[model samples]
Target: MNGKLLEGKVALVTGSGRGVGRGIALDLAAAGARVVVNDIGASTTGEGADLGPAQQVVEEIRAAGGHAVADTHSVADWDEAHAMVQTAIDAFGRIDIVINNAGILRDTIFHKMTREEFEAVINVNLNGPFYVSRAAAPHFKAQNGGNYVHITSSSGLIGNFGQANYAAAKLGVAALSKSIAMDMQRFNVRSNAVAPWAWTRMVNTIPAETEEQKKRVEGLMKLIPERIAPFVTALSSDAAAGVTGQIFGVRNNEIYLFSQSRPIRTAHTSDGWTPESVIERVFPMFENDFYPLHRSGDVFTWDPV
Candidate 1:
């Protein structure tokens, strides 16, 4: 890849103080885009705030001779999200890309989950992207071209235990990306979601109940966030104009294009049947089409390539 693929673009990345977001911000900068590194410096559970994280990333970019500015804004807030986008414009003169990577986790079984836990996860993991994307919508429309990259997860794409809140928010984010892609297609705006499997602080929280589980987690730790950033940077570039409203996954040396929901089977009757008749006939015909319940780990059992 050319080192200057994004040469004149200005990109904004939320929650870029560290981890996956930081990797993305740095990669975009290295690709020649001016970057707005926005991060509230919140913990894994979204409590407290510091400016150090964002500033540190910004300094790293500068040390590498890449343009970057730090913006300590909470993406969960509507006003702050807008300010984050505006910060890009004020600093670099335009916003050409927005990566909504801010998120928090509050995992627990549904029976034991609190309303506070659920809402907190929703506010940051899901609503944060909505607010940031909404703020960037008008600018993208005016510019007639832009890109949005939302960070999602396999937990939401499939399912996971003790993560009702996180899964719901991540899935909601994927849906939101699809809606935005459709809404802005006419103006050349493209939006997509990435389900990244990297061993970040969030992933470290998952319990390894057995020796096998512990070994699996250890293996995943080698799939660093940097491995995911190149794909994200490509998606943000003009070269990926043909791709939109899609879900993708990145592991160690693997990339996956996920299948979207579609009708697997259909049933009909010459005349509309009663509920009893429908249950007797239609249910039997489509019984085999029903999907078995499976969690995220169950589906992705192989080691990351």
Candidate 2:
């Protein structure tokens, strides 16, 4: 690959102060995109804010001879989100790529989860992407070209024990991206998502010594730190044009595409359709392989082993 594959393009990454977000932001910069590094500087649990993370990322990019600007805007309010995009517009004169990697974890079982906890995660993980994407929507439409990648999680994809709020927010983000992709098609704006399992501060919280925990962590580590960025980078590239409304699980040097296609069958009886009949007719759809695997196409498949 050419060193300047992204030359003249502009990429913006949110929650890029640390971990997967930070890695993605740097990679974009390295590939020759003028980058906008955004971070609210909140803790892993979404508490207070700090400006250091954003500034630090900017410095790293600069030191590596890449172009970058730092934005401390929280992706909470609409205005802040708008300003965040504006920062990129004012700097590079055009917005080409967006990686919505900013997120927070408020892990609690549904029964014990508080409204505040729920709202906080929703605001940042789900609404934050909404704010940024909405702000960029018009600009993307005007440019006639753009790319979007939202960071999601397996916890949300498959559900986790203590992450009801986080899971809900992540799933909401995936749904939101799919919807936006349809609107962006006319404008050449492609929106997709990445569900990453990395040993970041969030995953590090799970104990690694226990057999169960070790197995889980090891399975995730298969998609190492650097592997995740390639998925985002590919999505951000012109090569991935028209590739929208998709979700990828990235880790351990592998990328797995996920989908939700069920054997949707409608039943027809001789003018007598009861609820019982409806249930009985649909029972067979529950059989294995009735639902085709989602996004299991050649361009986006990986062997779990």
Assess candidate 2 and give its lDDT: 0.82
lDDT of 1 by residue, 1-305 (tens): 64789999999999889889999999999999999999988889999999999999999999999999999989888999999999999999999999999888888999999999999999999999999999999999998999999999998999988999999999999999999999999999999999998988888887788997798688778778888899999999989999999999999789999999999888888888999988899889888887778888789888777
Q: Kindly report which residue pairs in candidate 1 clash with one another.
A: none
Name the lDDT value of residue 79 in candidate 1: 97
Instruction: Summing lDDT over every window of 10 consecutive residues in candidate 2, give the lowest-scoring window.
Output: 292-301
TM-score of each: 0.96, 0.88
Model 2 C-alpha lDDT per residue in residues 1-305, reported as the tens digit of each score: 63577888998899888888888888888888999999988888877889998999999999999999999998988899999999999998989998998888877778998999999999999999999999998989987989999998777777666788888899899899999998778888899989886767777665567886677666545545555786788778887776899998876665678975454555466879787766777566555435343321222234344
- Against the hidden true structure, what lDDT does model 1 obtain? 0.92
Deviation in Å, model 2, residue 73 alpha carbon = 0.6
- Candidate 2 local lDDT, residue 199: 66
Q: What local lDDT does model 1 show for residue 168? A: 96
lDDT of 1 at 183: 91
Each model's C-alpha lDDT? 0.92, 0.82
